[model samples]
Target: MCACPAQKLCTCSASSLKKTSNHRKQKRLFRKAFFFLQRLTRGNQTDTFRGLLLKSTCSFMKNSIFSLILLFSAALTGFAQDTIVLNNGDVLSGEILEQTASHVYFKSAAFGSISINPRDIAEIRFTQDQLGEITVPKDAIAKNEAKPPNLPASKKPEKAAAKPPQKDTSKKTKKKKQWSGQAGLAIALRNKTTSNLSGVYKDEKYETYRLYGNLNWKGERNSLRWDWTYRYSEDEYKIRDDFFNITQKYNRSFKNKNLYATAKTLYQRDYNRRIENEYLQTAELGIKWFGKDSRVKLSTSAGGGYHIYDRLDSSRSNKTSVSLPKFIFDENFSWKILSAQELEIIQKYTHLGNLDDYHLVFSFGVQNKLVRELFLRVEYKIDKDTEVFYDDKGYYDKALLTSLVYKF
Candidate 1:
């Protein structure tokens, strides 16, 4: 009678409610299983599920053990066993590729490769299994050994053998001084036979002779040079031209070696030009634009000095003596075409207080070495002076000479 009242209040049975709860539980379990399978097979759709899983497992295991593998390798190989201790209390670890007298080459993982001066290194330590064995000093071994019984006074250790004195091999070598000289002579003779106006045969003889000498002494920083030339000519048994010149020069070089100070003196006499005698003294400063070591050398100088001109007829005529201040400019050029051949050019200008009264001289030459310290030279020279006497004759004089030179 009590169940009749409860059934009238409830519409579903207990068994149906239990079945519906079971269905919901099954659906939740299926969903969880599907999601778990999807997660395992993601990102590996082209491969079989078993292969993908195997690969992933292997990758994880390899990553987890990589550092352990590296550690074992380093321990076995001694990666940084080549150690260098520096004098400044620093230590460097690297693989030493080579050691030289002055430097060490090392390779480091961090720095790639580098050079180290031996002076900066205090010690080098190598692994026990390296190519070479480290040497231990006797003193170090003695310190590590046990003490021995004291020796008698007569058995004391002998003094170490004394080392022989070493030679001083660092001094600079000195260069030798150079000396050169040249001498030349030339002669010309002409004979003319003709009939005179009186129907008489006459003979005319002309003669010319020239002599030249030059000496040069070159040292490390100084040079001395001298040159002399003499010429005598007779035309038809009458003296036509007679002249001589002597010149001396001393040069002192400065610290630069390319710059120098020079003192020069000259004495000259000319009968054809009416210059009985002439004297000149000058101090000059010069620069060598191209040095002696080069294939070509050029030099220039400028100076001022006093000049004296004495004429042969000044004493007999009303002409006064010529004394004037003089200015001079000089240029010298030399070129070595080969080890045994050379070319030279020299030019000089002397101004006697006026532009119109000046003298110019130019010389050019070629020299070929024939033997050791001996050479052959051929030269051409021109001399022009505004103050010289010039009439129907030319205003300038020209000369060509071939000479042999010797050097010491």
Candidate 2:
């Protein structure tokens, strides 16, 4: 500040003054360059060096912007690519060209264009834009097409315009009334020989014959059943045991099909048991624990009814008639051990209120098929009664029977 160069200038050393002068010159050069560029662009003459540089710069910028736009468009299209997933865990990115009831046409960058069965594709993913106008057929997306080798000619797919409405033919076949029956016969012979003064004389000769039959008519919700059995035996040409029984039953099933109501009537005669003639009428409710087609079946019934019995008193040499209120319980069980063999067990209990007596009958049998409709049956039965009479030898009676049966 000893001697200022000017009013607003400050005195400095020689090196500082040289640096300030260099800075001033740089500023002047910058200002001159900026002005020269501005004047060159504002002029109308484009053939000069400045005009050519400006044109080149503008072209470069335009090319860079177009390149960016192209890259963005490519990225968007790649993100929107469709996908096809196959059943065998194959994934393919593609565009769907067309779809029909049985096949799909697709185009892919890697695999080119190809036609494939819709059955082979497990899933498909489409772009949002493609989904709006997709034309895939409903059946094509729903059901798998049958394979070519085993496919029927009638099932071949036609053109989309010729497609027909699908028809459902899956209704079950209606059942009709069915009838089944069985018949059987049995014969037995016995002989007694005594070795006395007369050598090997036939003392007793007797024969037994038995006939049995069963019939059933089955409908949708009801069934009718009939059973008949007859037995005759002679000892020394004199009738020894004569018995017959006939039963008729009508069964009506409930909505559950396993529960039912039954009306039954029975007529019977047994000379050995001293029952001359008996009649029973009853109404019962029954339940089946298993289906009819099951290998094992069990059914139980309980009812009360009136029974009229004509009894023969051998000691008194007279016949008596009695009417009683009876309570009855029945259980029937059958098991099919094989296709051709079956086992059956039947049990019945009867309680007589008037006589204050109870009766039980049980039968066990095995049936084996011998031919198409013929079977061999072996059965053992036991009958027991609480009532004792003069001719009632024991409290229980037992019998064994073998018969040949025919079924229809």
Predicted structure with the largest TM-score when compared to the true one: 2
* RMSD from true fold, candidate 1: 21.0
Report the C-alpha lDDT of model 2 over 1-408, residue by residue, as the tens digit.
445456345444666989999999999999999999889887765568778999999999999999999999788768877787876789888677665556677777887777678656767777744434555544324345654332222233332354686877787878563999999997644332212223223344455689999999998898999999998765443536677999999999999999999988999987655686799998889999999788888888888888898876554268889887788877888777775454443333444333457777777878788878888877766666655343233345566667899999
Instruction: List runs of model 2 lying over 4 Å from the truth.
Output: 1-177, 188-207, 315-317, 340-356, 391-395
State residue 277's C-alpha deviation in candidate 2, in Å.
2.9
Quantify all predictions' global Cα lDDT against the true fold: 0.68, 0.72
Q: Which window of ten consecutive residues has the lowest lDDT sum in model 1?
A: 136-145
Tens digits of per-residue lDDT for model 1, 1-408: 556857855645776788999999999999999999998878676577779899999999998799789888787546646887776788888676665455456666676667665556667777544444433323222122333333321222333368999988887878575987777665534343322234234454555578888899988788999999998876443545678999999999999989999989999987655676689898889999986688888888888878887764322344447888888877887777775444443333343335777877777878777777676776766666667543322245666656666655
Q: State the displacement of the C-alpha of residue 346, model 1, in Å, after optimal TM-score superposition.
A: 6.9
- Measured against the true structure, the TM-scores of the candidates, in listed sequence, are 0.51, 0.52
